[model samples]
Target: MSLQDLHGLLSNLQRNPGIPLDLDWVDSIRVNRSAAERRAATLPARRTVKKKYQAAWLLRAIACMDLTTLGGDDTPGTVRRLCAKARRPVRQEVLAALGAEQLGVRVGAVCVYHQMVPTAVEALQGSGIPVAAVAAGFPHGLSPFAQRLDEIRSSVAAGATEIDIVITRAHVLTGDWRALYDEIAAFREACGEAHLKTILATGELGTLTNVGKASAVAMMAGADFIKTSTGKETENATLPVGLVMARQIREYLDRTGYKVGYKPAGGIRTAKQSLDWLILMKEELGNEWLLPDLFRLGASSLLTDIERQLEHHATGRYAATHHQPMP
Candidate 1:
């Protein structure tokens, strides 16, 4: 019985915040050191591309946004609320700039704070891209449950099909796993048909073990995807953190036959970085995990750089940054 205290654990995790979560007893579950090493060894090879350096599939893969304001000013000077849009507005610019050139097979998802959802939503209209918003108390999950639920509602209302939220660090650190779990589960319920990406804010967790624990807890807590950080956190997504999360996701799926999603957000601002993380997921979870439903990369300034690299390869000359700075 590896953590079969469903009734008891569920009681501790949360109530009818109208969310769905899982009873996670992963810590009590053992780790297979041999299996871990085996996975690590095989991951690097999958990262290598079969084709030459091309830049055609990256654009459609990127969900680019900064979360300026869910329903705030689409105007400049509102730095936190502007999302480089009032300044850059390159979400579509990059798409058009890429023109017919296919972006590499990397880019994933874009993220923004709760307040910025609508702006990102509006900017990305007709671009055939999914809009993600940092709903609930994102940078900090201090707001009340109702408030957080409303925040999710607002983002969805603003046209966000994907909702990214944060687990309250205070609760998780205090051994209050149940509270964090319940909160995440409830958020999922509030999300309705929308996709939910929950941020563990790993830098704040302070250990790979804690990161592993949080990742498992979030998946069980009904998170459609478990993410690394908010980008505002002290430690954003790193290789080791990604490794730990991937390992947990692998183990969970191995046990339950249900494959959850993993997202490596923050500090992913380049093509190589994005590709490396994708390698981590693919190697750990297999080719089926390569799609957007299972994995995503949340970056702000990466799409165009990949484009420049691709264009240089395509045209035999360096591409200008002005071509399109975002995807």
Candidate 2:
């Protein structure tokens, strides 16, 4: 289906209303690192959609991107510029050449720090692009528990419809599953009506087994989505890590009948990497997971590369990176 059709379907689809936590299920989780790594290594060699089909997949990637700007120096001007790009991600000429102008194509959402939420909201006003804020002591997530909850509430009050809260890595590292569950559950309650994305910061979690268990815990505590990293980790969003988390999502669906979204942020900067993740989603969890609601790519430069590739596909010539700068 086209992006527009997918948007319509997403609007009517039911969000994952989380169920009560099942300790038995969370404790039973285990991951095979060597097997997962071997499987992930074979993905790039196995899947290759090219030409027009590749272009179509690129468009799908665009629709699933969380056009992001998360830096300490970010200002109102920068946030506004990012929101404008989120509104019209692809160049008009390129979109027209592909006959996708009427499809209303845009990125999944515009992500920013909590302080910049209002600026992004105003810039994307009436564009149907939700503003997402990284709250709950983002990146490290070391703040006091009460303060973290307060931050989520404050961001929602500031017009952020989606909250990306980070989990306390110590809870996962120390094997404090109950503490992890309680913390995420509190963040979910703080989110209220807004969708909550629990960032696992998988790079800091130590093992693939930990990543799988954290994924299960987050989903159990009512996370609308379970994200891979905060982009501040030493390593973020590897395919093996993604495969483990995606399998957890599939397992969650089978057991609880609730489908939680998956996002692999940080270090995803190329068009081919985006395609790899899409293929991972398609192969692991059907085409239904391809929609923006169920999947999101959290990156900024990734979009510029996708635009460049689409332009090359349209004009039969590759353009310099400087020609397609991001806002």
TM-score of each: 0.74, 0.97
lDDT of 1: 0.62
> Could you give candidate 2's per-residue lDDT for residues 24-110 as a string of tens digits?
887898888999999998899889999999999999999999999998889999999898888888889998998888888888989
lDDT of 1 by residue, 231-322 (tens): 78767988777777887778777766666777776777776666666677666678655555576766656655666665654556776788
Worst 10 residues of 2 by lDDT: 4-13
Cα-based lDDT at residue 131, candidate 1: 61
Q: Each candidate's lDDT (Cα)?
A: 0.62, 0.91
Name the TM-score of candidate 2: 0.97
